[model samples]
Target: MSEPKSYIQVLSPELLGRVFDAYAHKPDEEKHLIGLETTLFSSCESGFYANPVILSHVSKNWRNISLDRPTLWSTMIMVRPIASHIPKVENWLERSKTAPLTLQIMQTIPDDDTPIEPLREERTAVNTILEMLLKHIERWEAITFFLCIGFLPAFAEFPQGKLDQLKSATLNLATWSTHPQVVDRVFRAIHAAPELEFVSWCASFFQTGLPDHVPWQQLKRIELDVNDISEEPSSVGYVLDILSKCPQLTSAKFILGFCKTTTPKALNTPLNLPNLRSLALDEASSPNIAYVLQNLTLPSLHTLNLSLFSDEERSSANLFKAVGSLVGRSKSTLKYLGLDIDDEQLLKLLPFAKDVEVLRVGGAKTKKFTSLLTRNANNKISLEVLPKLEYLHLTYAQDAMRPHRISASTAALNRMVVFRTSQPPATPGLKKLKFISVGTAASSFQTAHITLILGTYSHLNLKSVRFEGN
Candidate 1:
C-alpha cells in the first residue's frame, strides 16, 4: 500500500461535472435524464436532451438502461431508408410498451428524377411506415410532416381547420403541376394547423392564390413563388393584404412574376405597420400601383430582395418608361437589394444603379444588359457605391468573363466579389469576400441561391469597391 505514492492530477471542472452526472441516479424529476435514448433528436427549443444520441455511451451499462423510457420514445424522425431508424423506433415501442408516439415524416426530393432510393425495397418499406404514421396519428406535440409525394397542400380553410395539423413545419414542392395529391395534402396540412409559425415553400406554377383566411396572423415568414408573375404578378394584392394584417410578419419573398402594372406609393391601403424589417419583391404591376410606403415607412426594415420574374411581355421602350417611374425611398434605409433584368430595358428604365450599395442584377436576355452598368460605372463614378458597403457581388449567367478587371481585389479571380483588403475578415466593418458561385447550362441554380445567400454585413464603416462585369 505504501508503494501507491504516485501523481494524482486535479480533475477539471468539466470532468468533475461529468463524474457527478455519471454517479447521480437521477429520477423522474430530471426533465432531461430520460431512460429511452433510442429515438428522437431535438434542439434546445425542442426542450429535452438536445442530442439524445450521446446517451448511448454513458458506459456500456447505459446501452440498454435508457432504452426503456416511453416518453423518450414518443417522438420519431423518419428521414430516409436508413433501415436502422425502423428497428430503433420499433424496439422502443416494444420495450417501453409506451403511450401514443409522435412521428415526424420527412421525405427528401431527389436532385434528378432518378428514383431517390434506387433500392426499390427501401422505398417500399419507407412508404409502409409512412402510411402507418398517418393512420396512427393519435397524440402529437405538432406535425412536422415533410412531403415528398407529389403535391402541395391547398388549405381551403384559412387558419382554423382540423386537417392543417401542424405546430411548426417546412413543406417544399418543386413541381406541383403534375401532382394533384401534393397540393391537396398541403392544403389539408395548412388547414389542420392552428398557428403555423415556421417556413413554407412552393415553387413553379402558373399561379398561387390561397384562401382569404390564411393563418397569416401568427406567421413569422412566408415565401410564395407566384407562378406566371408577369409584369402584373398575381397575389401581390393578397400578399400585401396579409402583410398589412399580420403585424408579426417580418420576411417576404416572390421568386417570379410578371409586372402588369407598377406598385403605387400608397399600396391602396389605409393600415400602418412600424415593425416591417425584411421585404423582397419584384414583378410587373400597374403603372399607378403604389404601396403606402411614402405614407407608412418600415422604420425597422433591414433587407429588400426584389427581382423581375418575367420580362417576356414587357416592351423595351415601354419598360424603360415604366422602370424610369418606379422608385423606393426611405433615406437609404434598406441594407440589401437584388434585381434581375430580362433585357437591357430594365437598366435603361430604372434609377436603381445609384440607390443601394449592395446590388445584384441578372442580364438574362443579353450580355448587353450590363451596358447600362458600364455606362454608369465609367469615369470613376460610383453613384450607388455604398459608403458603408462591405460587399459587392454579381453574376452574369449569359455574360462571360468581364471586359475589365476590378483593381479593388488582389484575390479577385478566386473570389465572387473580392474585398478592398486581403486580410481575412477579422474586422466586423471590413468587406468579406466569398467564393464565386456559377451554375451551368443543365442544372440552373437560380432560386436556390436565395436560401444560401450571404447577406450584407450591417457595418457602418464599409465602402463599395469599384466593380465591372461582362
Candidate 2:
C-alpha cells in the first residue's frame, strides 16, 4: 500500500489557493504564525504585512499558488536598500507580473550626535533598485522615498510622464543636504505624471522652497513639512502664495518651521477655497500659523486642527482670536475640531464651533473645560458649548521626573458625561455623548477608577469610556 497522504498533500488546489490568498493579506498581528519568519525582504516595521517569499518556500503547492498571484508581490517596502536586496527585488518584480506596485524606500536618520554621511555602497544599491523600478515605471501606483539627499540624483533621470499609473508620491529628505536643481528635476518628473493626485514633501523649505512646477491644479491632497533643523524659518507669505495656486485642494496640512516674519497684509479678498474640507496648521514655536488661518476662506471645511508650540499667553490669545474670526467669516458648519491651546482659549473658541461633533484637546488644563460641560444646579448643560458633541478626547502634558497631576478629576469627568447624556430625548440639536477618552501621565488614573466609571454608566449605554495612563 502507498504511504498515507499527508494533510497538506491531500488538499485540493482550489482550497490551497484560497488559503494562501488569505494568509498573504492577513493583518500584521495575525501574520506571526509558525512558518512566517523574516525572509530576505520582510520589513520589521509595525504596519507592513508578512512577506510572500516565505510562503513560496513552504511547499511546491504553496509556491505555485504564490507565484501565480501577482498582487501578493506588488507592494515592496525597503527600510534601507543595500546590495543584497537587488536579487530579491528583481525576483519580486518578476513575480508581480503586470500588477501595479506600491513602493516605500526609507532610511531613518540616526538619533545620536554623529554627523550623517551616506555610504557609497548604499547609494549604488539605491541607484540599481531605481534603475530596475524605472524599467517598470508604468506599473507604479504609489511611491514613497525617505532617503538622504544623495539619492536625489538617482531620481533625476526619471523620464517625465512615464508614471502613468501613479496616484500618490511622498518625498522626504532625512538630512539637511540641499540640492535645488536635483530637487527641481524630481518634482518636474512627478508633476508630469497624469494620474498623480496626492504629494507629501518634507524638506528644508528655506533652501528648497515649494517647487514652481507642481501639478497643483490636479492635486487633491498635499502635506508640506519644513525641516526642523534649518536655521532660517519659512514665512507666512511664502506658504500663502503656494496655497493660492492649488485651487482644487480638498485637504492640506502645513507643519511650518519657526516663523519670525510679520503677517502679510490681508488679501484684498481672502483666498477662497470652496472645495477644501480639512485643514491642519502647525508651527514649531511660532504664532504665525494665525496668519495662514487669517488669510483663507474655506466654505466647505468641516475639520480643523491647530497646534502652536508657543506657551506665551499673547500668542495663544491671538491664535484663538484669529480662529474665531475665520470660523465666523466662513460660516462653515464645523463637525470636528482639534486644539493644542490653553483651556481658557479653548473655551473662547468652542462658541464659534457649536456644530462640532468631535472634539480633541491636547496639552491643556482640562479642569475648567470639564466644569463648563457639567450640569449646573438646574441640571442644564450650556447650549453654547459643544451641544452636538458625540466624541471627546483629552490628552494632558506630562513630565517624566515629576509626579502626575490630575488635570480633570474623576468626579468632574463623570458629571460631564452624565449631564451630557441626561438631556431629554426630544431636545433639539443635541447629540448623546457616545465616546470619551482621557489619556494622562502614569499613575494619574487607576484601572479601578475606569472600571467604576464604566460600571456606573452601564445604563446610559455609552459606546466606550476609556482612561489610559502612560
Candidate 3:
C-alpha cells in the first residue's frame, strides 16, 4: 500500500500535526512526545498557520490537542485563511479560559509601491472579534492578553477600553492620524497600572498629551522611531520635544527629526534620558543628517548601530559624509556600529573615532561607497585612516569583492579581520579573513580563492586564507 521509502526523505508534510493529534487525543503515555515546542510549518507563512487551524476541522481530537501548543496558536497574527481561523482561535481561547496569552500580530507592507493601508474585506470583522476577545477573556477571568497588531493602524481601535488587561504591549503606528490618540491612551493606561511593565509605542510617547515632560521617573526604556521627519512636521520631532524631559531614563530610541525655530517646542525644555545602556537612531531623510549627528549624545551608550538606509541619492551622499564626519567625535563608547554609508562617508569618519573596535558595513556596497572618496585622492582606503579599527565586515553580492587600499602599512589594518561574500582581498597588513558567501561550491571556491589569494596580497608576510561555508 505504501511505496518503498526513496533516497530523498519523504516525511509526511503533516507528520508533526499527526503526531500532535495522537498525543492530544490519547493521554498520559504519548503526551510527552507532542511537547509544546514541536516545529510547525512557519515557512509557508499562510499555510503554516492554516495547517494548525485546519487540523481542528479533521476531528474534535485535533481541536483539543492543538490548544495545548499555545505557541503555535499565539503565533497566528494577520494572514490569509484568517477567516477560517477565526472560529478555531476563538475556540482555543474559549477553552483557554483567559489564562493570559501574549499574541504577536503584524501586517506585512509588501513593498514601497504597495498602497498604504489597503483595507482587506475582513478587516472590520477581524478587528471586531479580536477586540471582543480582549474584553471577553478578561470577563471570564481567562488569561488572554494582547492582540498585538502591526502595519495596521485600525487595530489600534480594537482594544479601546480594555488595555488595562494587557501585560506587555508594542504600539508602532507610524501615521499621524489617530496614532497619537492611541499612544496617549496606551501610555496613560500603562502609567496607571503596576502590572504592565513593557511598553513600546511606534508613535512617540513623549511627543504627545502627557506634556513635553511627564513625571516619568519610573520609566526605564523609551524609543521613538520616525518614518517621516522631512515631511512637513509629522509627530516625530513633536515627540522628541517631550522626550527631552524624560530624565534618568535607562534605554532610548530616537528617530532623527528637526523642528523649525518658529514652531513652539512640543515641550518647553530640552529632553534628556540619562543612564541609557543601549540605543537605536536612524534617518530616513538626508536633510537633518548633520544636525542629528552633532546632537547625538549618549554618555553610557555601549552598543550603537548608526544607519543611513535612505532612498535619496543626492542627500544620501551628503548624509553619508555627515555620519562619517561624526565617528571619532564620540569618546569611544560605541562597541558596535551598523553603517549603511558608502566609501566617501567612511573616509570622512576615519579621523573621528580613535577607539571604535567593531564595524559592520554592506557587502560590495563598500566599493561604490569607497570609490567616492578615492575619486579625488589615491586609491587607498586603509588602516592609517582608521588607526584603532578592529573588526571590519563587508556585505558582498554575487560580484567580486574588494576594498580600497588606504595604506598597506598601518598596524591596525594588519590586525583587521575581513568578512565578505567574495574571496578575501589580500593585503600585506591584513590579518584574518572570513568569507560569508563563497560562490558555487567548496570545490570551485578553492581554485578561485587560490588565484584570488595569490593575486590579493603582497609578499609582506600575510596571514592565513579561509574557505568559509566549508
Candidate 4:
C-alpha cells in the first residue's frame, strides 16, 4: 500500500514556493550572532545536502516546486569531486537558469592520503564538473575554490569572455609549487574578469607574474598569503610592486611568512593609496613591515589591523615604531583599531590612536587595556589615548586556563565599565561591548556584573552587548 501525502506536501506550487523562499531569506541569527564558521563536511557524512536539496526529495509536488525556484539552486556547495554526483550538479545548473551564482568547491583528499592522480575516475568526474561550471561562468557572482594545482590547466582552457559577471573570488591553491606558464595563464584568465571587486589568493606566485595580466586598479579588496616565496628579500619587493599597481584598493590584507625589509630606494619612494580605508599586515616577525608603513601615505585609512607573530620578545618594537611614525605622518582620523600585541606594546601605541572610536583586542588580556579607558587621579581621562572610544571588543576570554589573571581582568573590566558610565560627560562611555570566545568556556564571563551594568546603563543608549562563543 502507498503512503498518503500530508497536507503540507499537497500544497499548491505557488504556496510551497513562497514558503521555501521565505525560509531561504530568513535572517540566520545563529550564524551571525554566534559567529558560526562555515565547515566543509565530507559527502560520506549523514547530513550532506542542505534544505533545498533535501526538500526536492520530499514528494513530486515539492520536487517540481523546488526545480521551478531558480533562486534555490543559484548557490551550490560541493564537498569534493565525486563521479556519482555529476548528475546532481547538472540538475542544479539547469534549474538555476540565468540567475547569478555563488559556488563553493572544497577539494578534499582521500582518507588513505593517496594522490588524486591515481583516482582516474574521480579526476575525470572533476574535469567534467569544472567544464559544466565554465560553461555558465557569466553567472558566477561569488566563487570559492579549494582545488589542486592540476586544475589550473583546466581553468586556463576556459574562455575569458564568460567571466563578465564575476565579482568575488577565493582561490585556495592545494600546492605552492607551480610552473611559470601555469601561473601566467591563471592570472591571465583572472585579468579578464572586469567586475572582480574582491580577490583572496592564498598561494605563492612569482613576483614577475603580477601587474601584467591582472587589472589591479579595478580591485577594491585583496588578500594575499605568500608564505611559500623562496627568497625572503624578494617577498618585500613583491608586496611593494603589487601595492604600487593597486591604487584603487580600499581594503588589503597581507599574510607574509618571512620578515625582511625593503631596499633603501624602495623605502625612499612614496606611494599614496588614497582610497585605502582598511589595511591589515600579518607577518612572522618582519622589520620590513615598518619600512613599508613609513613609505606609504594612506589619507583615507580608518581601520588598521596589525598581527605580527614572533616567539622572541621585543620583535614588535620596530613594528610599533613604524606604526607610530605612520600615524604621525597620516592624520589622526582613525576610527577603528584591531591589535594582536602584548600589554606593554599596546599601551605604548594607544596614545597615538586618540580618535579611535571602536577597538578590538585579539590574543591579549583586557586587564591593562582597561586602564586606557579609566580616568586618572585628577578625574580626567587622557585626551591623547582612546578618549573618543565608544565601542570595545575583546577577542580573548577569561577562563580557568588562566586562573590567576582571570579574576583581576574581570575586576578591571568591571571597574572600567562602571567608571566610563558614571563619568559620561567627562569621558565618553562605551555604547557597545562585544566578546568573542572561540573554543572556550562561555560561562567564564560574570553574568551578574554584566546584568548590573546593563541595568545601570539602560538610559545611556548602551543597549548593544554581545557575547559570541564559537
Cα-lDDT of candidate 4: 0.63
- The best-first sequence of candidates by lDDT reads 2, 4, 1, 3
Kindly list the per-residue Cα lDDT of model 1 for residues 370-459, writing each as its tens digit. Answer: 232322222333222333434445543432321111222222222323233232333333333332222322222334332233233223
What is the Å distance of residue 198 in model 3 from its true position?
A: 5.7
Off by over 4 Å in 1: 1-85, 88-128, 131-167, 172-195, 199-209, 228-235, 258-271, 282-296, 310-332, 342-384, 396-419, 422-470
Ranking by TM-score: 2, 4, 3, 1
The lDDT for every candidate, in the order shown, is: 0.43, 0.71, 0.42, 0.63
Please report how far candidate 2 places residue 329 from its true position, in Å: 2.8
* Candidate 4 to native Cα RMSD, angstroms: 6.8
Model 4 lDDT per residue over 322-420, tens place = 777777776637888887655667777787776787887655555666777664536443434566667776653553222212223555766666555
Local accuracy of candidate 2 as per-residue lDDT tens digits, 228-340: 42457656676687788889889988776566546667778788898999998764343566777888898899999876654542254466678777878888888999886
Q: What's the count of clashing pairs in each model shown? A: 51, 0, 26, 0
Better of 1 and 4 by lDDT: 4
In candidate 2, stretches whose alpha carbon ends up further than 4 angstroms from where it belongs are 1-49, 52-69, 81-87, 111-125, 152-156, 174-180, 204-208, 226-231, 284-287, 313-321, 375-384, 396-406, 440-460, 466-470
Clashing pairs in 2: none
Cα error of candidate 3 at position 183, Å: 8.0
